[model samples]
Target: MSQYWELLASRSDDQHTSEELEMTAYRLAVEQVLYYADRHSRTAYWMIERYEREFRQALVPLGIDVQVNRQLRYAYALPKHAKAGTASIAQTVFALVLRAIYDEAASIGQLTEGGEVLCDLVELAEKYRLMSGKELPTKGKLDSLMETMKRWGIAKKSEDHGLDDGEDMAGQPYAVVIRPAIADVLGEAALARLVQFKAVASANDEPEAVTSVAEEGESQE
Candidate 1:
């Protein structure tokens, strides 16, 4: 495993050098996710695709599971026993709503070529309230919470989506552009949890149950 890169590098001139692969491996470890549709990560994503097997083998000892979503054209690494990170309950609900929205878009074949989905803030608030039986945070607080989603590689801001002009976020209708990564981050299991949580909320359950679900279903790597 130590010489995995070298072994692959030795294969052919077409094979990238050990140092190049090593650097990519390090980046993947640090970043945890890459998408072919992301310009900054395009090369790195291709590199991983090229050496998927070696990368998987090399990462096994580190308890890192590498998964590639072929349809979505993205790769992500999951750390053993880790949720993307510790997320606040608000963020957990936000992710759930985003995931549900993404599913709706995907089902209708409305996903962009990059597998991104557009979500208006108004719709987001509506869905958030519907799902959690709580109001979405104010714009200011939402900004802070959204950083968590960005860090988890599940969502991107409009500016990041190549918005025209130097349009100010405050001057326009805010939107949450969800990345394809959300599909993997919060899968069908998340939707199931939503049904479960909705029932709990309807029953006027204690905070602990909902809180526990949020903590457990936090975004994935």
Candidate 2:
């Protein structure tokens, strides 16, 4: 197994507090899922389940519903249906790219500030080590992808002039706006997966538990 895999497995046997353990495990799971999915072309649901079963129980208690299979289908199928006339391969690639970006942004708990630019894409691709077997996209292809995203309202671009310079910059950084509708697209499954992963990871590290933290602090006093 890879070092990462070993780390994840060993984490299951750690004696850290529950919260600390859970956080470590959650990060590992997310990184692993992204790595595995990108390499195997597996759907998000599969990644979710793989990590969920190992790390946490379920997020239902947090008022998040998780519908596993439905989320998988929607995550994979919607883009195809959304752009019927376009090249299926391109559409699919774009959808996966967007999903990866959105997932990373969500994990970080904040959207990027660059207008219309999904900054996470490059980071995710590098983390997953995804390289197009084909040559890099031509300018036209990139433009088409941007246009499709804009049309779908998944992203938008705007230019703001710098008052200090009193100059209108050409092609200023684009800000990519993520639609709230994306949450509906993945449904409750995503939340459930996150919750389950958290729980399982926490279980592995007893010291890291929330209760343990409180107890330890009290004992120190």
The digit string of per-residue lDDT tens for model 2 on 130-191 reads 42222224456656765655444344333211122212323334434443334434333332
Model 1 per-residue lDDT tens digits across residues 1-221: 44877877787375678888888887776676788877888888888887788788788887776778777788877666554435544566677788888988889999887788887777788887787777778877789867778777888777666655334344655578898877665656666656655554543223231332222433332
What count of clashes does model 1 give? 0
Against the unseen true structure, what C-alpha lDDT does each candidate score? 0.71, 0.36
> What range of 10 consecutive residues in model 2 has the weakest lDDT sum?
209-218
Give the lDDT of residue 217 in candidate 1: 33
lDDT measured at residue 88 in model 2 versus the true structure, 0 to 100: 34
As a TM-score, model 2 comes out at 0.33
Return the lDDT, model 1, position 204. Answer: 29
The numbered model that scores best in TM-score is: 1
